[model samples]
Target: MPVISYELPDRFVAGAVGQPGERAFYLQARSGRRVTSVALEKFQVTLLAERLEELLDEVRRRGGDDAPVPAATPSELLDDEPLDQPVEEEFRVGTMALAWDPEGEQVVIEAQEATEGESAEPEVGDDDPAIAVLRVRITAAQARAFAERALKVVAAGRPPCPLCGNPLDTAGHVCPRQNGYLG
Candidate 1:
């Protein structure tokens, strides 16, 4: 969700007579990026910005503009008062950091350097890799997609458990995945 540009075309005159001209613009959204062109008369351009503002206002009121991805939760976990903190899960590839969230189901995949003591700022670029965080209410199809992508990414590397930082070499373990009973 970046504001790539906000400018008027040079060909279109602000107060020109005759038929109204057309204008084009660019906007980049999260799901995908697109270049949109609008054909409007000179008078329409001024109104366009205001109209867009009003439309955005309405969208905000309806909670449709920039709506956050809802996190997933088990039915039993949806009590009035949550008993425990949100679980912290980490998927790793080699020594690079991927996505991270304190709470919520949205998985953000972006590359960030590991600072020895403090949280390092993410490096900005077109080629940076990302980690996807899944929500509790994510559907089976969505979950499968997330898992598949993560597998493809981590498959080329080994991941260490977040708790013990031990490499999960095989299926044998008494960790959290084993229910802690050590059967």
Candidate 2:
């Protein structure tokens, strides 16, 4: 397996490209000149952000006020920049793992490449050379920034219909609550 690991990367973020409904989401990590971008579904990005927040909150609660984790993303750490240029996808993420490193006081995020017909659970210690992983280690503040940005990116998509909660297209969409009428 090829692992692209960034330890305390200079930049790590979630961003998207293209218009509203047609957008593609990506997770990017850059350290010095080396950059790694991984493709993933919008839902994946949303879940990652939500989970990261929950994880950080739990850590803070357990560690009390002395924890390095912050209640919010520090203003200086808030990154609103777009994904790095080229936006080349190294791999499509299949499974993702997140953890809080107590010793390093960092959040570790690992996105594993998706494989066709792969087992639901990744085997421990299974070295599959075909699989590629993008691993990024970032401070709690950085993680919070990333999550906040990711949620914004996801929300930037097409607006949802009030009737059915389905995304509305530029020309409108058929809403289930409206009996398939364009709403």
Candidate 3:
């Protein structure tokens, strides 16, 4: 397995390319010049962001006021930059994991490459060479910023229909609430 690990990377962000309704989502991590980009579904990005927030909240609740976790992302930590140029995808992420490093006081995220017939759980310490993983360790502040950006990226897609709550297409769509009429 090839693991690309970044400990306190210079920058890490979730971004999308293409138009709103036809966008492709990616997670990019960078340290100096080395960069890694992995593609994943929009829903996966949403779940990752929500889970990160929940994890941080739990950490804050347990650790009280002394916890390194912040209730909200710091303004300086907010990242709104587009993805780095030449957004070459290294792999399509199938599974992801998150953990809190208490001693290091950082959030750990691992996105593993999708492969057919692979086990649901990651193979710890395995050197299969076929599996590729992107692991990043970032401060709680950075994690909060990442989640905020990811949610925004996901929400930046097509606007929802007023009646049915489904995404409205550029050419309009068959709205269920309108009895399948194109609205």
Q: Compared with the true structure, what per-residue lDDT tens digits does model 2 show for residues 1-183? A: 698878999999999999988998999999888888999999999999999999999999999989999999899988888899999999999988888889999998888899887667653234467899887889999999999999999998998898887889989998889888878
State the TM-score for model 2.
Answer: 0.94
Candidate 2: residue 3 lDDT (0-100): 81
Alpha-carbon RMSD of each model = 22.9, 1.7, 1.8
Error of 1 at 114 (Å): 2.6
lDDT, candidate 1, 1-183, per-residue tens = 221221221111112112212222111111122222222222233343333334334434555545332232234322222112221213211112123222443222232222344344433233323422111222222322333332332233335665654445456345575566332
Instruction: Give the per-residue Cα lDDT of candidate 2 at 147.
Output: 93
By summed lDDT, which 10 consecutive residues of candidate 2 come out lowest? 119-128
- Number of clashes in every candidate structure? 8, 0, 1
Clashing pairs in 1: 20-41, 72-136, 72-137, 105-135, 107-133, 109-130, 109-131, 110-130
Each candidate's TM vs. the true structure? 0.18, 0.94, 0.93
Return whichever of 1 and 3 wins on TM-score: 3
The all-Cα superposition gives candidate 3 an RMSD in Å to the true structure of 1.8
The positional error of residue 88 in candidate 3, measured at the CA in angstroms, is 0.6
**Can you tell me which runs of candidate 3 are displaced by over 4 Å?**
123-128
Off by over 4 Å in 1: 1-30, 34-112, 118-143, 156-183
Per-candidate local distance difference test: 0.28, 0.89, 0.92
Better of 1 and 3 by lDDT: 3
